[model samples]
Target: MTTPGHLYLVPAPLDFGCAVQSPLTDALPDATLRAAAGITHWICENAKSARAYLKRIDAIHPLATTIQAQNIVELPREVHKKGDHHGGFDARPLLAAALQGHDVGLLSEAGMPAVADPGSSVVRAAHDLGLAVKPLVGPVSLLLALAASGLNGQNFAFVGYLPQDATERTDRIRALESIALRTGQTQLFIETPYRNAALLQALVASLQPNARLSVSWGLTLPDGRTRSADVKTWKRTPAGPDNQTPAVFAIGR
Candidate 1:
């Protein structure tokens, strides 16, 4: 008998499961999967959150029998940590899941995997192993921030991170500012939470006084807040006396 396919890459709606947020857990494409039943198994990127998310909807996953009971095959982290992508795959827990005529699920800490997280290794490995990788609509921080930012999302790029060195980072910021001002292309970037205040200060100082700036902080959470205004106004405001909050900052003309 031919070996069964391996896994599914399901996208959890970006901001799912809130009072006003759309829940993706209820919508995960599990029905199509349930059709083939020998023993249903799931291997989640974040074992902890996956359990909680499913439990919220009266769905109980076989955590003990799978990763817990040590019954199913596991993808070691060493393969990715020492592999081609290097530390980029560190965040991705499962690397090379084995096929057992059962289906596995590759997920992310939030939203979809492989978009901005380390789940790419699992997806790539599944392809190499000739496994079926399927995905559904999921919440993504990138698009969420852009949509709420109200910037020119039509033409935008997610420049993942900035340089480490202060001077180099400052130069990169200047370059991004110039691009946003000249081309009207929304420049979006993220930074470590600790450096958010510093980054905000730099943005207020470097970006054109009249340039539009939107800082989407704590999105899709109880304290979710979005601040959009001109750089000049942001500079004058006494908001960041240490505004070390998790946020996505966007700058554009």
Candidate 2:
């Protein structure tokens, strides 16, 4: 019987969409880079973007081979929208290379795969198939934001994204705020880059004056900023454009 290959959960840098490229060595350890470079087969959120990331790493450490020689299987756009657990997604076929004793890597466009990112189905499938899953260390924007927020890090939850509708968004923010105040659990969520300012405004309007709100944008980038303040303070302060940079929003007492 062929020994099943291991699944490497490789992490990409948090500066994915930023204008400048972050140094790979600074963000990723050499072991993670080597592990990523060694794997040629990948289940990725976007094949083109994955190839580009691999090429960037290859420029520094040199991949086992060229990017063209790598085998990449992209997760469907629907998976990205509805998440990987939308049912009917059999990730076993994607791991066929692994069955043949060849290692496979799961990659996200930014940050770690399978965590608040499309590719959880693949990780679930790996567990079901008894494949050894190994996650390499790298930058995670959520943890970074939580640590920087100075909130209740001991008890926090990543609430994902908030509702888009005005009423629903306000309701959701208020609901999360209630939980934060009662349990001291830091509530974390994100918004589409273009909607950052709008969400910030809504947050300021919905949360109580004393409730603290933290907004982190362009994490791991040179101009990245993480600011935490009470809702009242935020309302008085002039709001700056996030410019569609990826951001994390957190609320706590």
TM-score of each: 0.72, 0.96
Collision pairs in model 2:
none
lDDT leader: 2
> For residues 1-253, what per-residue lDDT tens digits would candidate 1 score against the true structure?
7575566665554343333444433434455223212223545544566655444333333332433333233335553244323334432234333455656666555566666655666776677677777765545677778998889989998887777777887798899988988899999887766788878777787677888888886565556777788888887883742244456788887
Count backbone overlaps in model 2.
Answer: 0
Per-residue alpha-carbon lDDT of model 2 for 27-93, expressed as tens digits?
8999899889999899998888999999888977889878999999998788887886555688888
Off by over 4 Å in 2: 85-88
lDDT of each: 0.62, 0.89
